[model samples]
Target: MSGIKLICGKELDRVFRDRKMIFSVFFLPVIIMVGIMSLVGNLSNNAQKDVEAHTSIVYIQNSPVGFPQFLKAADKDCKIYEMSDWEKATEMIKNGDADLLIKFPENFVDMVSGYKQGDVIPQIKTYYNPSEDYSRAAYDTISTGVLEAYRQSLLSQRVDNMEGLTVFTVNSDNPDMVIQDEEKAGGKILGMMLPYFVTILLFAGAMGIGTDMVAGEKERGTMASLLVSPIKRSSIVLGKVIALMIISGVSSVIYVGALVAFMPQMIGGADLGMNLTLNPKQIAMLAVLLVAIAFLYSAIIVLVSVFARTTKEASSYVMPVYMLILVLGMTTMFTTKTPGEWVYAVPIYNTSLALQGILTQEVTTMQYGITLGMTLVFGAVLIGVIGKAFESEKVMSI
Candidate 1:
């Protein structure tokens, strides 16, 4: 245990001194998160502003009518561009010179009056470019305004005459169904991103530190020198595994911390209205899950590293494992089906799924215990296997 601690300290110092290691574990993730947030925030703000701006629409009619006055009165922000030719109006809209093009039927006034007097309403034909998002929104807004004006005209005519009508009461199981939109958003973002981020950072940290411990040592001829030392083979394996776990664990913490720090800003500026802040209990759960993930990934990476003749070979060997982790982490995004108990026994899958639950504040004690236990058990088995590999004469020769 003392030897393992000493080795862990040495490995931690080495990583701190290495500029490349520092960038990979800390700086890279921070840069990526901040850059992505800034880009998304700018795009969202622009979309909202564009939607708010009530730009000019070209109206084409065969005969003069009062409908134009109704549209103009609907919103003070609206700008109406009246045109006699439908073709010219359409061309303007298509060329981005106009926001919208409206065409009124020849008998539009008669049709509206007839409908108000208990006649069948004719379906109004509206043409819009489905490919344009803003065009669709503008069409909806204009249609809604026109309908409200027509309803108001009808109501004004019937203001002096009224009749009593029967009213029915409704009974509902969900009477006060108020959705806390903020909490829902927080839960959704955490569920979607937490697992993926944890898996990626864990794999990256393990690969970075594991390569140095095994293949790098071999290249430096330090493995041969270490073999001649009076240390037991199991102790050497233990030491390396501990060191790898520390590096992976520290990286996971940094990645998660970056996410937590950005959550308030994300909720405030973005549509996520969640009044969420992580408390000590949630932090503790996340810490435990991170530790378990680090241990499991470290053991697997060390085993893969032991089989490699060089750092390049170790990275190649680790690629498939990393891909598998990515696929499992993304399982939550595409799946609505609940994972079976057997899935909780899988190493990376268990930790990632559990971390997702923790972040969303939906994790149960039983689920957490099962995931943590399985991760530790698998890690122990993997460490035993790696220990045997390290003791082998063939592995030492490589």
Candidate 2:
């Protein structure tokens, strides 16, 4: 234990002293995150502002009733430009010159009236470019308003003619109304991203440290001298793995902290509308999960690196492992439903999913314990493999 701790301390000191390590482990990740956040923020803001500022909508009509009133109401939000040419109106939407384009069939008024009189009416067709996001939103709002107004007009006429009929209204209250907001939805998205980023940094940091410890030492001819010493081969592997784990673990902590520190300002002030704040308890849970991920990834990378003769070869060998971890971490990002129990049993998947659950404050004690236990188990297996590799003549020859 003392030997492992000594090696851990020495490796950590070496990492801190190296400018390249400082830049890669801490500076580069933060810069990449901030750049991505800024670009996404700008795009969202521009989309919303463009929708609000542009008011020119082209509508093609053939003497439709109530269409004038709909246009009048929508005019309060934006200027309505009614066009006779459907091709031109469509071109306007396609070229981004118009916010929306509404097209009415030649017999739309007749069809609507016939349907009101209990006759079959042909379906009314409304055309808008689906490729334009704002056009889609504008058309959705307009269609909803028109339908509601038409329904009310029919209801009023029925009520005027039926004096003997009575209408009863029943109201149901919703208890979960507080959770119905864009801010909550954005927070949920962030929950998915946070854990995945932590896992990525864990894997990256582990690979970086493992390459430096094994292949770098071999390249520098320091491994031979270390082996010649009376130190046990198991002790050496344990020392290297412990060092790599600490480096990876510290990198994970810093990566997670950077996100947590910036999340409130980024999500709240940005257009994402996530008004979430992480407390100390959530931060602590994230730290624990990150530590487990770091240890597990470090053990695997060290074992793999031991088989490589050079840093380039070590990196090449470890690339597939990193890719697999990335794919597993990203599983939660693309999924809407909570992950299953089997997902929690997978190594990297468990850490990523559990971290997401922790961020959202949805994690149970059972899930947390299971993920941690699985990580430790995998770490033990990886350490065992590294121990065997250390005993091999091929590794020494390398």
Against the true structure, whose lDDT is highest? 2
**Quality of model 2 by C-alpha lDDT:** 0.74
- What TM-score, to 2 decimals, does candidate 1 have? 0.83
Q: Would you estimate the TM-scores of all the predictions?
A: 0.83, 0.84
Which candidate ranks first by TM-score, i.e. highest? Answer: 2
Clash counts for all predictions: 2, 0
Off by over 4 Å in 1: 18-20, 54-64, 83-98, 115-120, 144-185, 264-268, 334-340
Tens digits of lDDT, candidate 2, 58-172 = 4655636666676667556655666777777778878767766555667765565555666664444556777777677667766667646755564565467543553643344
- lDDT by residue (1-398, candidate 1, tens digit) is 77666666777788889898789777787678767776777777778777677464545454236656776677556666666677877776676556666665667666755555566665544555545556666677766566556656755654554233215445557667766556545765777777887788778867867877887788788888877777777778888888888878887778767876776554336665445567788778878878877888888998998888888888899999889888988887665666677777777777877777776677678888899999999999999999888889798678
- Compared with the true structure, model 2 gives a TM-score of 0.84
